[model samples]
Target: MSTGPGADSAPAPTTHDSRSTPEKTPPPGTRAKSSMFSSLKVRNYRLFFAGQVVSNIGTWMQRIAQDWLVLSLTGSATAVGVTTALQFLPMLLFGLYGGVLVDRLPKRRTLLVTQTSMAVTGVALALLTLSGHVEVWHVYVAAFAVGLATVVDNPARQSFVSEMVGPDQLQNAVSLNSANFQSARLVGPAVAGLMITGVGTGWAFLFNGLSFVAPIAGLLLMRARELHVVQRAPRGKGQLREGLQYVAGRPDLIWPIVLVGFIGTFGFNFPVYLSAFADDVFHAGAGSYSLFNTLMAVGSLVGALLAARRGTARMRVLIAAAVAFGLVELVAAAAPSLWLFALLMAPIGMFGMTVNVTANTSIQMGTDPAMRGRVMALYMMVFLGGSPVGAPIAGWITDAYGVRAGLAVGGAVSAAAAVTIGLFLARVGGLRLSVGWRHGHPTVRFVPRERREELTAAA
Candidate 1:
């Protein structure tokens, strides 16, 4: 790949160069340094990135405030779970249709509408809280509205990244996006906690409501001249079914989606567990709750940065990370003290990000440009849609078994899922697992030794 002033001006190279090239031309499979932050070189992406950073910080703040508010009002773990479920239920019900809409519409326009809708929802919630008349049912209604917007917003946003950076730098752009989200996660909760303690939760919601202006402004400011536009498919019959078939045919896409569904449904429902840990297990207040999330975000930031440094997405990395994530959660559940539980959060965040970044990068890289929106919609369904099913179950478990046992159940389910899926892939892919460290980096060779011996015996 060549990196130069005209990098975006000139069309992407049609064929790989075979001869030894100059330093400016990176070797095949090796990305240029410029590619690490290449999307920023595009004016549109720069605006989008900046806008999302501000908006995402507020989004995180609102999440913490909302959870805290629910707990304060009801003092029920199951209530918190119900709120979360109400918020995500829309995605579970209508996410596929939302994806089809994204495919049929202009992503920028879709985002503008969704962002505005979300801002309105936030403002309403803040107003209700400020009036001191907020009720649990009011929160429930608002949560559902936010979730409805999310079902549309998520697919539009995921597909929008490819248009911003083009295919050449898609992996880098996606990794950086994850990094931005984690960075916000690190800052948002701590800030929200302080703001809530010093002022009120209403103010946190107000801040979130105002934050949408940045992204809206960024959307308005985008230089449409620079976008690498994908041709929209004509409205046709069975579009949703087509997307499903397309993904079902590819094991690489299918298995990861399955894995994420299991992880999201069984292991990643943090609201229920976090609330229980804060109120019941540690007897800590909101500050400690925010601190726990901040620590997890710190580890997530590290994971995202490491992912950004990589040039390619590999399937084995996804599998290993999923297994590691599950095990870490198990350890966290078993911790004897608050500090130990917080400590385990770091590895949990790290491996969780690894699974997410790897799966996201792979799905984007592998999909056809025309089908990107729909494919990503299906991906979101597996990712976020699972939360509705998982949150209530997690909450009930936390209510029944105590927080520790609830968390342990989630971890055990996630671990079993990873091992089962990983082994199934090995068999289907004809892989044997062997381990060694190459240049100090651990490596697993997937082709089985016995399979190799059998082939040799036949020969």
Candidate 2:
């Protein structure tokens, strides 16, 4: 996912590193606990989680501020998209390499470097903008710089959770991570909006720059003794190729990445969508733009909490959530009034978060820990990396046709991709779709193809 400014694809084997997997058991004397907050019990994860909550709010704030600043300067939606694209372009070019880099280094140290670099980018922007010397090109350069840092930060962070919480808490921890981000989303945009309106965008950037301090402190504070470190991938010439080949062999892993490519490329360019709607369609200005994001965060927070309650991430959930996400966006695109559009943003946020959390948790829980950094890099590359391609296209469409056309195109592509991938996976896995009402509610089920045939014959 882009890690907003928002937001994985893949089914993967439920395995650990080449070394023996954690036994789905708790450490030492602690009993297995599966609460939504189970992962927080670990002192390391609690610290990490707390720091991330602070950092994520700052992230979202900067995202909103950055986009608004571009729009204010250029008054061009395409320019805004250009800024977003620049921010994610490096992830497309170097994200997999970053995974290789993470597999070779100490994750804690790697994160500190990436975090510090990003802070510098934020601070530089703050300095330029606050001094009243900032320009569109400066924002572009800083956005690209941040993207360069994220190439390492993203994969390192994804694979680090296991060390902090172990296999037993991996799924819950990932869900809570999404939840924590959404909670931050709820605050970040509203705060940024106010800061941009009442003060200026520079303050938001400055606060974001400072927020990096929290994660660095948390990393320093963690006890090395308690970490459940996974074996690092051995340094070798073929390591990157090896990781790619490993994923190619695993259907559970590769298909999800493919599906996400389509969705992320077309479906998830909300910075473009929301901004165009707020500025062009609604003519409501920064406050309206912020409100749209806040409403979506409200839905996203609800979705993340729901995801945290579930013990497992199923393929069924990913497909359903994605389908719902696309459909809701379609509905939202057609909303006639600003209030109705804002009202519809909630479900769009909910289903979008579900698609994100379900895919991320499923990928993390199902992959080999040794291969995780690489696999997650691919997952994120597909998710955030697509912004480079999609953001501009969305911007162009909005510029040429309208905001509604851009959104509808994205929604249609997303929904179509979900259906296509869902069926292809079923055929590959020897399952068939079974749709019927089990009680009062409509339901969709996947069963063995033979069983599906038998039931059809009996019917």
Candidate 1 lDDT over residue span 86-194, tens digit each: 8888988898888888877777778989999999999999999999999988888989999999988998999888888776666678888998998888789879999
Stretches off by above 4 angstroms in model 1 are 1-38, 67-82, 127-138, 274-289, 395-405, 434-443, 447-459
- Expressed as tens digits, the lDDT of each residue in 1-459 for candidate 2 is 121110011222334344334225334234344676878889988989988988999999999999999999999988987898888788888999999988777787788899999888899999999999999999999999999999999999998988788777777888898889888877898799899999999999999999999988887777766777566666667778878988898776787778778888999898889988999999999889978988898898888877777656677778888888888889989999999999988898888888887788767766767778888999998888787788889989988999999999999899988988888888998998788777788977889989899989988
Stretches of candidate 2 off by over 4 Å are 1-33, 64-83, 124-141, 193-202, 276-287, 395-402, 435-443, 453-459
TM-score of candidate 1 to 2 decimals = 0.82
Least accurate 10 contiguous residues by lDDT in model 1: 16-25
In candidate 2, which residue pairs get closer than 3 Å at backbone N, Cα or C atoms, i.e. clash?
Answer: 1-7, 3-6, 11-252, 13-366
- What are the candidates' C-alpha RMSDs? 6.7, 6.6
lDDT of each: 0.81, 0.83
Best of the candidates, TM-score: 2
User: Residue 452 of model 2: what lDDT?
Assistant: 90
